[model samples]
Target: MQVQKFGIEALDNMLGGGLRSGRPYIISGNSGTGKTVLALRFLYEGLKMGEKCLYIATDKPPHSTITSISDSFGWDLLSLNVMDAVPTPSLYSTVYPVRDVTAKGEIREISEMSKNVEKGELTMESIILKLELEYKEKFYHRVVVDSFTTLKRFGVEEERRNPVMAKFFRFFVEKGSTVVLTVEGNIQKIRPELILSSGAIHLKREVQDMEEKRKIAVLKMRGSFFDPIEREFIIDKNGISIRKVKSK
Candidate 1:
C-alpha cells in the first residue's frame, strides 16, 4: 500500500515510513495539544510535494489562522486552497477566490458568490456540496478540517451528525484524498470518527515537574506497523519536532 508523510519525521518513522494513503484519519486531543499545527504540517508537507491541498477552516476565520501559521513557519499558505466555513465573516480570501461559501453550490462568478454570501450559513450538506465542486475542479490530494467538534455542533443537528460525518468520510475516500480531521476531546474516550477512520493519532499534554509535556501516539493504523509509544514532542517557530527514540 502507498503511504503519505505526516510531515513530522519522527512520526513518519513511527508509522513505518508514513500513514497509508487515501484514508481518513483523526487527530484527537484536548485543546492546546497542537492539533491544528499538526494538521497544517500535514498539508504543508503535501504542498512541498506539489500536491493540491485543501483546508476547511471551521473553528476560527481561515485567513488569520493560516496567515499566523504561515508567518510563524515561513510557509506560503496563500498558495493552498482554503474553504472558510467559519460562522463569522472571513477576513480574507485564499487561492480559491470563492471561499467562505455561505451559499449552496456552483459558485462560478464573483458576483454570484457575493450575492449568496448572506443568504444563509453553510450547513454540513452545503459544505459537502462545495467540497464536491472543489474536488471536481482541483482534485485535492490532501484535506484538513481544523476541528470536527465545532463543525458537528454547528453544521448539523445531533440526531444526524453521525450519518453526516459518515458521508464526510466517504466523500474523501471516494475522491482518493487523504484526510486529517482534528477533534477536541479526551483520547481515552473513543469518538465515532476514531472508529470510522482508517487510523488515529492522539495528542496528549501532561504537566510533569512543573513543566508541560506533549506526547503523540499512533493509536491504530491499518495495514501498517507502527511504534505505539507516546513519544515527546516540542512545538517551536519551525513547527513540531518529535524527540528521537534511542536504540537499546
Candidate 2:
C-alpha cells in the first residue's frame, strides 16, 4: 500500500514508514496536546513532497491564522491553499468549535450551533459542498480539517451531525486523498466517523517531573503494521519532534 509520511521521522518510523494513502485518520486529543500542530506538520509534509494540499480552518481565524503559526515555527508553508470556514458569530448564526484551551490553561468560549444561519454564512452542508466542488476541479492529495470537535459544533443536534460526517468521510475516501482530522476528546467515544476512518492516532499528555509531556500512540491503522507503544514528543518553535520510548 502506498503511504504518505507525516514527515516527523520518528513518527513515520513508528507507523511503518507512513500512513496509508486514500484514507482518513483522526488525530485525537484534548486541548494543548499538539493536535493542530501535528495536522499542520502533516500538510507541510505534503507540500514538501510537491503534492497539492488543502487546509480547512474550522477552528482558527483564517489563512493568516495558519500563516502566523507556521511563521513562528519557521515552517515555510505560505504557499498552502487554505479556506476559512469559521463562521462569524451572530445571534442566529454562531460559529462551530466547541471550545479552545490554551497551553497555559486559559479557556475560550465557543458558540452554539445556529438555529437559523444568516445570509452569506457557512453551514455544515455548505462546507461539504464547497470541498466536493473544489476537489472535482483539482483533487488535493493531502487535506486537513483542523479539528472535528469544531465540526461537531456544526449541526443543532447530534443526530443531524453524525450521518453527515459519515457521508463526508465516504466522499473524502473516494477522492483518494490522505486526510487528517483532529478531535478534542477521547478516541473511544461512539463517534460514527471513527467507524469509517482508515486509522486513528492519539496524542496523550501527562504532567510529570514538574512539566508536561506528550505520548503519541497509534490506536488503529487499517493497512499497516504500526507500533502500538506510545512514544514521547516535544513541541517547540521548530515544530513537533518525536522519540520512541525505550522498552523496559
Candidate 3:
C-alpha cells in the first residue's frame, strides 16, 4: 500500500515507511502526552510537502495553537487553513457560534452564523459539513481534528458515537485523504467500538526512576505492519524526538 511520511522519521521507520494514504487514524492518549504536538508535526510536515492542510480546532483557538507551533518549530503558519469550532461564550446557550481566524489572521467564512444557527443545530454532523465543504472546496490532502471527543456530547448520544464516528472516518477516506482524529483518554478507557473499524495509535507517559518517560505504539492498522515495541520519546524546545528503548 502507498504511504506518506508521518513527518516523524523514527515513527515513519517504525510504521514501515509512513501512514497509509487516504486512511482514517485515531491518535489516543492522556492529557499532556504530546498528542497535540504530534498532530502539529503531522500538519507541519504536510505544509512542508506543499500539500494543502487543514486543522479543525475543537479544544483551543487555532491562532494560539498556530503561534505555539511557530514558536517551537519556527514554522510560520499564516498560510494554513484552520476552523475554530468552539462556540462563542455569549452564544453557548444556543447553537450559534463563530470561529477564531485563519493562518493569515482573517475570519473564516462559516456556512452557519450566530444569527442563523437553528435550535438543536449543534450536531457533529452539521459542524462537519461546514468543514467538509472547506475540504472539498480547497482540496486539502491532510487534515487533523484535534480532540474530536470534546464534542461527542453535542448532539450525538453515547450509544451512537461509534456509527457517527465510523461515518466521520469514512468521509475522509472516501475522498482519498488521510484524516487524523485525536481521541482523549488512554487505551484502557476507550470503548471497543471506537477502534473497531479504523487504525489507531496510542501515546503514554509515565514516571520512571524520578524521570518522566513518554512512549508511543501502534495499537492497530488496517493493512499495514507497525513496530510492536513502545518507543521512548521526548518533547524539548526543538520538538518531539523519539529513541529506541534500551534494556535496564
- Among these predictions, the greatest TM-score belongs to 1
Best of the two (2, 3) by lDDT: 2
Across 1-248, the per-residue lDDT of candidate 2 in tens digits comes to 78999888888888888888988998888888888888888988888999988877777665455656677788767567765566653221112221111101221112222336554345566566666656656788988888667876765366677677777777778899888988888766736656778888889899889988888998888877888888889988878898757778
**Reference-based lDDT, each prediction:** 0.79, 0.73, 0.71
Candidate 3 residue-wise lDDT, 45-156, digit = tens: 8888888777887777666677776888786555567666654422121121222223222233333433355543355676666655555456778888887777555567
Off by over 4 Å in 2: 89-117
lDDT of 1 by residue, 13-114 (tens): 888888788899999999999999899989989988998888888888877888788889887665677777776655655443434433335644222334
Give candidate 3 misplaced runs (Cα > 4 Å): 90-121, 192-197
Better of 1 and 2 by lDDT: 1
Which number leads on lDDT? Answer: 1
- For model 2 the TM-score comes to 0.83
Rank ordering of all candidates by TM-score, starting from the highest? 1, 3, 2
